[model samples]
Target: MGPLLDDARARGRTVVALSEYGITRVSRPVDINRALRRAGLLEVHTQDGMEYLDPGASRAFAVADHQLAHVYVRRAEDLAATRAALDGLPGLAELLDDEGKKAHGLDHPRAGELVAVAEPDAWFTYYYWLHDDRAPDFARLVDIHRKPGYDPAELFLDPVDPYVRVKAATALARKKLGMRYRMAVVPLDPSPVRGSHGRLPDRDEDGPVLICSRPDTVPGRVAATDVKSLLLRLAGLDGS
Candidate 1:
């Protein structure tokens, strides 16, 4: 990539490099769905001894993603009750309602009724089951689509399982032989995850970065949303 960038610069081609956000260190994992379930707002269904979230039947449930979560309330009447139930939850920073969502530019039809932000040192987890034994089969595997929310724990092998590596190797071998395999080696614990993003960075140095090949073409600061227009202008396609 470095050589390619140098080559592009030598060729006088305009280049723009950017990132969505920077990850920060996080230690606290907030069990948002568990809290809602305990509050009688979240509902789950049992299938073959494993519990899965039933969003349709649930009065309220949270879809956690890194340091943020969207709390979907089934009915407007249950909004106050759901909000009250989440009160005093540890690692929670703030709850965004209608006005708050508008202020944050999150007021969309698909967005949840309530949005939750976590503290600087904390993050939200997708774990809902109280016990590991009753967890869904996909909970231990790297099955992203099956899970309701983002799970950084999928990046790691289960450290608690002594034979996790062996099992993973075996699963790969089985797949190579054209046999059915389930790579159920991901850990249920979220403590191993040390970094996450999604919340606004407290420091500018910890935020996203944008680098332009031609320094004169870009301002000293760039807004996240303005990147598209800036790129278009740089490419001479914005009708400047």
Candidate 2:
């Protein structure tokens, strides 16, 4: 990597290093959907002893994403009640309504009716089932699209499952043999997830970063939204 950078420098090419966001250590996993379900706002359907979220039939539900969640309410009248239901929920730092969404630039039509932000050292989970035995088949597997929310637990193997590694190896062998396989090794527990990011960083050092080889084209500080314009400027395509 150093040699490549040196070669680029020798060729008079500009280099830029950037990151979308920085992850911070987290210990708490906020069961946001479970909270909504406990309040009777979220609904689920049972199939073969497994529970799956029924968004269409539900009054309200939460889509957890890292340290934040988007709460979708089916009815306008349920908005206040939904907010009240989330009150005192552990690790929930803030709940954003219409005014709050507008202030945060999250008032788009596609945005959820309410946005939930987790505490600094916490993250939101999509687990809606009250019991592990009733969890959906995909809960123990890394099925990103089917989960209905971002799951950091997908990064780990089931720590309590003694045969998790063996099953994973078997799945890999089956895949290599061009056979159907299910890599159901991911954990249902979110406690092992030690890092997450989504909420605004309390300090600048904890946020995203941008570094440019051409000092003249770089600003003293850069916001995440300004990165694109800065890149265009660096590429001499912005007519700046």
Candidate 3:
């Protein structure tokens, strides 16, 4: 890294690096979904010992992962009830309304009407029901497809290492190969663009599968390079 930086400096190229917001130690984990359920704003459908959101019956529901939650009200009439229910909650640090969203540039069509943020001492989880057995199938695994929310826990190694654990287990099952493999985590930016929330684009713009090829065969595959080139090709922008 030092040598590369030095070479870049010699070549008269400027390099800048920045980081996202920092994190602090968390003491408690808040389940915004559970809160909404308790408030009678969210409804669940149970089938075969699993639970899923009953969007038809729900007045409001929360999609939470990490410290942030986006609360959506199915009907406009339930907005006040949702706000009043979450107000003065212990772990909640802030609840951003329409005014706050406008101030924060989060009032876009894709943005939720209400955003619930947890305190630094607490983080948010996606659990809507209390019982572990009742959790949705996606909750028990590293399934990103079924869960319609963000999951900051996927970035860490603790509690669950979705990528590594799955790969290791797969490798152990096929040990006859006696080979090592790598994994590349390509992040498809899910940040909502105005008027594009919850709706798929007419064509592949920037959204694609979360994976490319297996690590061993990635050297000359479609996504051989970094994530940027891979994503570009996936979007049919790079003229693959």
Q: Of the candidates shown, which would achieve the greatest lDDT relative to the real structure? A: 1
- Which residue pairs collide, candidate 2? none
1-240: candidate 3 lDDT, tens digit per residue: 899878966876544332222334455656777778898888988988998988678898887756677888987898999998888777788899999878755687966779877775666666677676586656644567766566554454332335756765665556556766333232222121111111112333322333332234234423212556654554468975
- Writing each residue's lDDT as its tens digit, candidate 2 over 1-240 gives 999999999998889998999988899999989988999999999999899999999999998899989999999999988998999999999999989999988898988899999999999999999999999999988898999898888899999999999999999999999999999988888889999999999988888888889887786888777889989988889997
Backbone clashes in model 1, listed as residue pairs: none
Candidate with more favorable, higher lDDT: 2 or 3? 2
Stretches off by above 4 angstroms in model 3 are 153-240
Task: For candidate 3, list the clashing residue pairs, or say none.
Answer: none
The clash count for each model shown is 0, 0, 0
- lDDT by residue for model 1 (33-132), tens: 9999999999999999999999999999998899999999999999999999889999999999999999999999989899999999999999999999
Q: Whole-model Cα lDDT per candidate?
A: 0.93, 0.92, 0.62
For each candidate in turn, the TM-score is 0.97, 0.98, 0.64
Worst 10 residues of 1 by lDDT: 217-226
Minimal lDDT window, size 10, model 2: 216-225
